[model samples]
Target chain A: MNPLLEIRNLSFSYEGSKSLVFEALDLSVREGEFLLVKGPSGSGKSTLLRLICRLNPPLGGTILFQGSDITAIAPARLRRSLCYVAQIPQMIDASVEENLLLPFSFAANSSKSPPSREELRAMLRKFYLEEVEPAQSAMKLSVGQKQRLAIMRALLQDPLLLLLDEPTSALDQESAAMVFSIMERLNIEEGKTLITVTHADYKPVKKRPLNYMLDNRRLNLLP
Target chain B: MNRIIDISLAQLFLALLFILIAQISSFIYHLGLNRDITIGTIRTFAQLFLMGYVLTFILKSSNLWLVLLVFFVMVLSAMFIVKGRVREKQIPYFIPTFLTMLISYFATALFVSGVIVGTAPWWDPRYFLPAGGMVIGNSMSALAIALERLFRDLREQRELVEMKLALGANYREASDELFRKAVSAGMIPSINAMMGVGLVFIPGMMSGQILAGTDPLIAIRYQIVVMLMLVGSTAVTSVVVMLIVRRRCFGSGEEVLLR
Candidate 1:
């Protein structure tokens, strides 16, 4: 079974900061693996996720996606295939419907049709956004609703691999539980690869997820 | 050709007395503009007089090379202003800015010369220098606004762009909104000037033509041509600069080259 993603000797530092966020790091994920990364704030946990998707190019080293150098893949294609959801969801100053359909408008994703209205209503309803209209401004949504929308937007693209940064950090316990359940289904039942970065110890409720602790710019497996 | 009367040095000096109105007003208001006014007056006298002698020699010789050299220098000075004034700290824009000015300034210059004012040699200093100056100067201002807005928007909205990229947008797609805004901002000045031209104000070019004894109708025609030319060049200049700068600011792999 080939690895879905691989990082080789990755070394990186912020533009101004001298200290390396991640140095000489390496890791790999199998096609259906559910991997959870745990670390304190400023541990480069989020940076690691971004690196996987080639958001911030590593100063030194190579990333491989599906046996090809990650740099070789077109950025739009790479992003569409491996969607990333940030910790603080940022919404365009437009309606939720437009935001939801945003990815489908991209050249990479344009070939695919947007999710149908019924599907959208179902997704929104599942996330407790029942009262929110499709044309409601995404900016006016609560933080939790925005997070759900961001996640749903990514799902709309039908990504093969998903990298989520603290997906439920802003949610109430009930919302967080709902999001985690959805993530579990996507990882377990749907067989999609998932890599999640979080400060909390979030164990996968359904499938046994591999836990890794990042320290001193290295990833260590935890049994 | 009608020979025009020239203002004598004494008349010019007497005209200078009009400065007392501003000097007196500044004194009464305590506007602190006396120093600025003095320095500006002196600098205007010195620069224009120097430029007058230089231009007279260049015009007499009709040296195309010298004319082009001066034009090149003008372009350089324009880029220098953009470099210092544009607040973007990201990608090295000196070359892109230089390229933008070069394409825009030359395109407008050639259009005015080859198409509009058909000089015998086509690079006639009399037509090329002044026309190119207006095109280049106005285009420079347009590019300044375009480039400044582009970088500022990108810097301030990095996350928005990144999020777009994350959602699978190419650089052009990701920056569509900012790009449109910058281009529009660049063009708005000339557009607004076009709206207000001839009605609210007599533009300097038209007044200069009229003062030089050209018929008012003929001056108005020239003004209209120049106004249209300015708006056209500004649009072309802003678009070219934005296109080149857009490529420089965003990398081939869809990574933002801001750093």
Candidate 2:
């Protein structure tokens, strides 16, 4: 079977530097695979993810998704299918509901609209985010709450690929477990592909996930 | 009480009317600031009263030097406002504002008085001073918006702007969205005035001319000229300010101004 996502001969360097971070690196993920990437700080792990989302471009090499070059794809369409959840989410100055609905405002997702009111409440209830006060400002939410809100925003897009960069970094242990459990359910139960980069060796409740580590400017299997 | 000079009730009441107009302007923003209202009223009374007495003395003496001095004072005060508000350590904030205001308002006022209204001396107190004040006031506001936005855009979006450059967007394309936002913000108040004129409220210049016993038709014609000048001056000043400021804002490479 064809890989769901593929990176071939990817090489990059910061501007004004005669060094390569990931030289001639190749990786592939199958459908519904849970890949956890481990790396030390500044190992180009974050840069690799950013390049996958097209936030930054690789100096050389192509990133292909579903047999097509993602770099050549239109930005709006690529962003719709492949959502990048940043380590620190940037919320526009708006309400919680408004932020959740922001992705729908894009032309590609507008047809999806939003789930019905009941569906929205049900979805929020799963994450314990009850809509008790719709008019309250989103800035008032705690960091953990904002992170969850960012995840909800990504889920709202109905994206085929999820690139989560340290989603559980700021959460307490309990919150981290809840988030990981939800991610596992999405991967195994719902059959969505998830590529998460984390420092921890987290074991999912549903599916046993594959692991990779970034060391010596190369991605290698952990096991 | 040297400050307590003879003033008629009708003059005081007309002054109070303008004060009230300024006071009620906060309704649009829901900023029901009664203190702001009272302070604004007192300020308007003091300023207009001083100008009235000072100009009366100048008109009676008909001294050209005194009138020029008053114009100089206005320009200096305008420079102070721009410098304080912009507060840029790198650029001389006052120079851009002074040059912009002088070129825009002075040129328009000269054209209006010399060619159109045909006032005697072309710098007549009855014509040139008030016209210059109106044009300069609007230009100062537009410059404030443009300068504030240029500095803020540099500070806030350093990463995303750099990302745009990586994505094959040129310097022009990378900055175009931000430049458009800044220009739109600079143009908003004037656009609102255009939309609301003769519907929600009459502008101050037309009202003042009408109250001064000029024909309403002539007042409105002059008001139209002033409004058009305001739009022209705002557009010209913002573009010019952005062009001059953009040089200092960008570095040699993809690096942007941050700090």
Candidate 3:
């Protein structure tokens, strides 16, 4: 199958910084592929996801999403298709149900109908947040719950790819395990494409994921 | 209309007695405001006298170009004041903010003087200058507050805004809350003033007119127009400035660019 996303000779550096964060880095993710990138802290792991989402402009090279230059596509459209979940989940000052329904509020997503309450409740259950009341304030959720909720919200958009930054970095071991299980389910059962960047030594029990090490501004496949 | 009584220089000098009381309190309380009081007094006399002479010349000449030139100068000064107040180094907002102020102030002043007041020449120095000056001056402070709040809030809430963007919200949708807040910050003072206008105290313009021996009823009418004019100008100026500055906060990729 043709790659769903491709990166060619990507290079980026922060403004006024002498050193490059990523130099001539290359990556390709095919449909329904689960890829894990492990790196030390500040290894530009988060930057990689951001660059794919076009949150930060790449100084050189190109990002192709579905064989089209991401820059050529409208940013909101690109972002909606390749949704990102930040390391620390951010929730609006509203109910959990409202936060879940936030993406449909955008003009780009206006054509998509919001999930019904029954559907939303099922999603919350599938994400291991079955106890979370829809009407409860999203801000009151624990860090782990928020992360799961963030992933669930992204899924509601029905994105082709999910870019997760440190999906389990802030969770306890049990919570981390729960998140990993969810990731496995998303990839194996739902056949959803995922690119997860983490600094942890995590390996999914049920499926073998293509692993890469990001270090010294290079992404190398780990045999 | 009654004939106005003019105060002689000697009688005006007696007004210094009030300054003397303030100075005495400052000295006794060790407030160290004596220097500020002295400079303020000097500036009050020099600036007001200079403005009086300049107004005399402009009114006597009645040249439309000259009146417009004065209005431009006022707007330029107001822009710099706003620039000094909003301390954002990342975004180059000075030119856009200045242009917003110029357009909004000019349009609002023209409407008030030509359409409402029905000044014969429309650029009549007597009505246009003061009307434009008030619009620029009040909106200047409001713009500063709005810009300050906007840049500060954008920096503080960078993650929140980016979260919205990541969820496919456009720049406008992402920063909608911040935009509303900045506009509100700019408008609250004027709204509060409106609430307190006639009941809390006679406004400065109305008081000045009454002191100039204009009939109280007529003075009240002018004051009402001035008050409403300020509200309209402040709202328009703040909204326009915020709209322009909001675009500067984002990049071509629709990302939050605040450092």
Top-DockQ candidate index: 3
Predicted structure with the largest lDDT when compared to the true one: 3
Runs in model 2 lying further than 4 Å from the true structure: A130-135, B1-144, B147-151, B154-181, B188-226, B232-259
Ranking by DockQ: 3, 1, 2
Clashing pairs in 2: none
Ranking by TM-score: 3, 1, 2
Please identify model 1 stretches exceeding 4 Å from their true place: B1-41
- Tell me the tens digit of each residue's lDDT in model 1 across B13-83: 88778788899999999999999998989888897898789899999998889988988988998888777
Error of 3 at A115 (Å): 1.1
Q: How far out, in Å, is residue B110 in model 2?
A: 15
Model 3 achieves a DockQ score of 0.83
Kindly list the per-residue Cα lDDT of model 3 for residues B1-259, writing each as its tens digit: 5678889999999999999999999999999999999999999999889889989999999888888888888899888878888878899899988888888889988988899999998988888888998888888999999999999999999999999999999999999999999999999988898999999989988998898888899988998899999999999889988998899999998998998
The TM-score between candidate 3 and the true structure equals 0.96
TM-score of each: 0.93, 0.59, 0.96
Root-mean-square deviation (CA) per prediction: 2.5, 10.8, 1.9
iRMSD for each candidate structure, in the order shown: 0.9, 7.4, 0.6
lDDT per residue, candidate 1, A37-127, as tens digits? Answer: 9987899999898888777878899889999998889999999999999999989999999999999888898789888878898888866
Question: Over the full model, what C-alpha lDDT does candidate 2 score relative to the true structure?
Answer: 0.74
